[model samples]
Target chain A: MTTLSAGKRLKSAVCSTEIMVIAAPDGDVEITCGGSPMGDGATNGGAVDPGHAEGTAIGKRYVNADGSLEVLCVKAGEGSLAADGDALAVKDAKKLPKTD
Target chain B: MLLEMAADAFGDRVAFVDPVADSSITYAELLAAARTAAQAVHDSGAERLAMLDVSNLAIPVGLFAAGWADVPYVPLNYRLTEAEIDALLERITPAYLVTDLTHMTAFGDRQGVALTSRGDFLGMARGGGGDEDYRSMDPEAVGVLLFTSGTTGAPKAAVLRHKHLVSYIFNSVEFGAADEHDAALVCVPPYHVAGIGAVLSSVYSGRRVVQLANFSPEAWIEIARTEKITTAFVVPTMLARIVHALEGQESAHMPHLQSLSYGGGKMPLAVIERAMQLFSDTDFTNAYGLTETSSTITVLGPDEHRAAAGSEDEAVRRRLQSAGVPLPGIEIEVRNDEGKALPTGERGEIYVRGDQVSGEYEGRGSTVGADGWFPTRDAGYLDEEGYLFLEGRADDVIVRGGENMSPGEIEDVLLEHGAVEDAAVVGVPSVEWGEAVVSAVVLKATATQTELQDWVKQHLRSSRVPERIEFWQELPYNETGKLLRRVVKERLDSA
Candidate 1:
């Protein structure tokens, strides 16, 4: 179990999925990938569970039901992202007005 | 962290393009280049990484590389005279200087200076090799050091920390929000605050950027057309020239141009109105901020522009001249001379407070007050409806015979005249009055000095009317569109 924070990049220990935290609620929140705890960018491969084999996609944001935890998928992979065994849902992207 | 976010989120998407070189780099490629450049900067024994070139592919690489190498990125104004550039370069010794060939030879012989041409820098960036990881940088580390245009006094380096810039992006821009096809055309010089802001925000949003080294209305319009540019940012003068260039034509002819944002200088109402009519389909946003504020503390968004233009109500329509509302997490207050906040509609100095507001200079440290408010030194007020209206810089206020008046008020009246294309009002030394209001005007058609003087008198009181009127083919402006009031005053005073 690893603490979550904004801008923290977490890589899957089992699959090729990579996620960056966009928002996290106060206190530590355990983030997992394919039923295994996520690791930092340097973490290598580990065993993958078949139960959570759904994949992640690039440029998509996943958020929990409470909306307190949010992570953006930076790389696509076969491993699904979860927080304490709860699967995250693809957040509906909001179209922001263009301003430079 | 910002560029890394972009690279990881959308690695394959194009991050920047150099049309002159006919080359482009993906976000992944940009990240790799930054890493390599970081290694060179680390190995060069340079304390600060300075870029002294025009907008090019090497710019972004150098910027991110400096951040990755944990060095402050100083983008010097290349338009300055040789002596001025020499002075600034001397100040930042032991600097890794990435400049064009011309400047490299000019300043390369300095002690403890590591020089590389812009092309060779890009070549090195393409060849990826770096040991230091920039992702673990301290939030408080200085990210950029921008020297303010010394219109009033000696240029001071405004420092922007990583937290400030990151907070600005996180608060205002959404991560990975841009569509794959969306692109921004960046024409502002690297020295300008808008230029830096544009690059960072565009990268974080995952939008492609097309750089224009030199700006002309013809070139700008052509690039927007050929590149299918969806969004663009320009100073008021640029938009004015674009509008003048498009005169007598039915439309701008660029269908892909979706949004146009203008700032950096006060925009005349006449120019914006004409531009709105010319680019009828494009959304216009008026962004207002300072170099110390990281960028755009307030923005007059597209909806407000349309509403103000279309509305018949006098109050609603006047918003076209206002600077709009503050961004989220930014607090703006108009305060009187006594440092007391004035009620709405009472004009005073503009002060801003926010996480993104650094308000710190190189040697001066942070000028931010105990309350976290930074005096912008600009004169303006919020209307009853909370729309911020800027009334020129506080130092630019023209005091004539003890009656303090705003040049912006007088200039706005002058611009209302149908014959006047542009106007600048300055206070000149006067034997009779403490200082006399002098006007320098650029006219769209022939108009006599007496006629123009009469025009101001009819619109405002006699005291506000310019005592001396001079007609000029064009008024002096900095490349970024700021009116050179000091230059105007000097010229008129000497004459």
Candidate 2:
């Protein structure tokens, strides 16, 4: 189980995927990619599961239900993301306003 | 962390370009330069990295270097007098100053200060190699130290922490959101918060930034057309000047120019309306914030702009004059002098609280309350629907015969006159009324002082009319479009 914290970057142990924690949950949660537990950027490789091959895209935010967890993908990968045995949905964001 | 993410995601993409110099840098190159410069700053043992020049490549390099070196990046105003700059330089001693060739001799010998010209700084930056451990650094470390413009008093260095800046980005902007073809034109001076915000926001959004060393309406229009700029940010006066440059034209004629955002000062309704007609195909955003709030805390988006312009309801149409609602993570409240939250439509001090609000100064302690709200010192009220209408700085409020009056209120009335182009209302000394209303206006068509006074009298309280009126060709403004009220008072007081 990874202790979720805001701004912490995590890497998939199974594929070429990277994400940073934008909003953390109240407690430690086991997050997985391609049915393999993810690790920090430096980690040992693990085999991918065929059932969880929906893939991920860069620059998209993924969030689970209840609105407590949010992660932003920094790199694309051919592995889907899951937290606590549930799938994370890609958030449909509003067109951002230019704030500069 | 922001640059690291961008470099890792799209390292080969062009990031910053200088049109005049005909040069550009990629995201990876900027990352490398920042790391290399950070190492130099670490080796010199400087407590801070300060930049004192017009906007250039040194800005991005100096900014990230300071962030990576764990020192606050202080951007100095190139427009300041030598004595004024020295007074500020004295405060940030044990600092590394990155300046152009002209300023090398004046500040090179200062105690506990290391200096480099822009030329040498770029050279060292280009020879890039260093390790960055920003992920391990403290989130609360100071990231930027911006001195308040201090039109009211001596400049105070506002402290912005890493968390505050990062929070602002995460709250308002999504990473890598700009399309590949998007190019942004940045022309504001380095000292202004909008300058810094424009860089950081554009970088994180994966937009190519085109820099203009100086601003002229002709230069701005030429670059925007040539570069196919999709997005840009400007202060009110800059927008006004651009509108004037295209005075006889119906459209800006650059189809690729998609978005334009303006802030830093009150935008005259006439100017914005004219700008809308000129850039009919473009989206207009009005962002409102202060140096202490990282940049924009509120935005009136393009859709809202169109709605306000098209609405049949007088109340809905009045939103053109509003500053819009607060950002996602920000909370705003209008409060009276007793620190009590006022109801809607009651003009008072605006207090803001959020992770991005850095209310502290270098020497002076924080003005943030125990509950985390930072008093903006700006007088404004929220409409029933939560649109904020600014009434100018609270300090600028006029006291006429023991009654409080807002100058913005009276100025708005005068501006509604058909012939008046610009106006400034000031409270001058008057023994009878304690403070008398005085005005100086710029007119496009000829209008007499009596005619203007009657125009104001018809719209506002009789006591609100200016006791004396002075007509001038133009009013004094700083580089960022902020009215030099003190200068106006001095000029009119003497006249």
Candidate 3:
């Protein structure tokens, strides 16, 4: 297995977060608490962003948050705001942790 | 380069066979046609030409004509829009655009051959499009300007020479062992190197080529069984679909298959093993090469696959993952960021240098390093046995928090999920970590993102598990059958 450096550890630590995410339409979201910062590392490459990021004090609407998240972006960066609403609908919100 | 040598040595032998139309051409005839085309092109005062329609008959003829005429021929994908073709025409500014009336719109005013007039050429052409007596041309000189499939960005042209194609044929034949009696089936498109290679290799080996106008699972099986195909090159997805199609049907479609070669993207070990089981008698070779090198540089032969695979030995398993040793004439090296060669088993970028190496074309895509070696963006390590193992593309590598993540590694695990049909793992921007490992999956059965996440978390370190999972009916792919990671992500961002 490959070794992870301290900096990578810190990066992974930041990326590995538990948070209650409400998926929003237009890839925009409103984080009630901790989550990855908007535009912190988002790129045009079309890769899925690891919801793991260091959250700052403020929350801004990064995506359009048109109330379109099928599964509440319960975990920041864990998934796309645009998801199969039905697949996520099966989950119970109370079972999710408030902060990761 | 090898083609010329072969032509010189085997001029009168039948070189190309259009199995679809039941026609064949001798090496001498092909050389003569190319020569004639070269003279015609030279007389036409076209220093540079653009070939828009890539029917098998037109491709080799155009290539040889340009070479014989001492001009460069730019190959354009037939799928490109007129505007895109116009833009390319503007960049190359060729004196002529070689195509038939069907695609005449692509060249508003450029001179071309009315393919309707090329009857013999059409019949002799592998897939059978235009029927014209195409001029034969030279063996030497730069020929093709193929564009890269723009999955990441705008497509850029990759310069290809006759030598590149010939050299690949020379090297691959030992592993493939195609002979005059072999009837090879070609289903890949001709615009790309893989497609071009399939056609050229068949011709070079004097084998019969049965062309599939387009790849449909049913059509492939039909053609293979009907034509008694002996060898073929296929992409992973094509293989998967074929396997899926033949799942319960015990048929003779694969009975005549002597060998199966695959590349253009990574294939899961399970997929390959499954293929082995399906075609137990046929030899399997996993090839690894880019368009720049014509087709393949390294191939894992069936023998090595069986010996090194699932040995329960780390060293043996590592060999199984390798792309195999460099071909006889190709030079390969693994280097650090500085371009200095590294010791065996050290991960670094792959660089290839040899007769087969085609320089970057039209100043597009990545630049060649200071040394002549073309920087393969792919990260891999050369082992003590001289085998090369691929990790993934450098751009595709994910650095989550601080740890480097190979999406391929994670993807291999996800492929184990019985419900997963296909999966693409990519890095998304993260404010907290440098990058996040994100996965988009297409499945045979339905599942939620949470379920997938939990499943992945169980198999991998939490750092390697995707922070997000999206389900799609299908993943976007380009013309050459490579997944379009950027397009898939765009759907997510827009969603």
| Predicted structure with the largest TM-score when compared to the true one | 2
Distance from true location, Cα of B247 in model 3, Å: 1.6
Rank candidates, lDDT, best first.
Answer: 2, 1, 3
List where candidate 2 sits over 4 angstroms from the true fold.
A1-4, A10-18, A27-56, A75-80, B130-137
**What are the C-alpha RMSDs, in order, of all predicted structures?**
3.3, 2.2, 25.6
- Candidate 3 lDDT over A14-40, as tens digits, reads 232222222334432332212223222
lDDT of 1 by residue, B1-495 (tens): 778768877889999999988999999999899999998899999999999988899999999999999999999998888788788888888999999948446688888678899989999899765444536767779999999999988889999998888778766787777889899999999988899989999998899999999999999988999999999999999998899888899899888889999999999899898899988999999999999999889989899999999999989998999889988789999998789999998878999999899999999998999999999999998998899999889888888899888898889889989899889999998988879999899899888888988998898999999878888889889999998889999998887
Judging by DockQ against the true structure, name the best candidate.
2
lDDT by residue (tens digit), candidate 2, B1-495: 788878988899999998766778999999999999999999999999999988788889899889888899999988888889889999998999999848545798888879898889989988867565544545779999999998988999999988888888888888888889999999998889999898888888899999988999999999999999999999999999999899899798989989999999999998898898888889999999998999899989999999998899989988998999899999999999899999999999999999889999988888899999999999999999999999898888899998889888999888888899899999988889998999999998999999998888888889999989999989999989998888988887777
The global C-alpha lDDT for each of the candidates, from Candidate 1 onward, is 0.88, 0.89, 0.61
TM-score versus the correct structure, for each prediction: 0.89, 0.94, 0.72
DockQ, each predicted model: 0.32, 0.52, 0.01
As a TM-score, model 1 comes out at 0.89
The alpha-carbon deviation from the true structure for residue B194 of candidate 1, after best TM-score superposition, in angstroms, is 1.3
lDDT of 1 by residue, A30-70 (tens): 88888788886545556667887888987678999999998
- Candidate 3 stretches with Cα past 4 Å from truth are A1-100, B1-14, B17-24, B101-140, B162-178, B250-253, B308-322, B340-346, B363-366, B445-448
Cand. 2 Cα-lDDT: 0.89
Q: What's the ranking of the predictions by DockQ, best on top?
A: 2, 1, 3
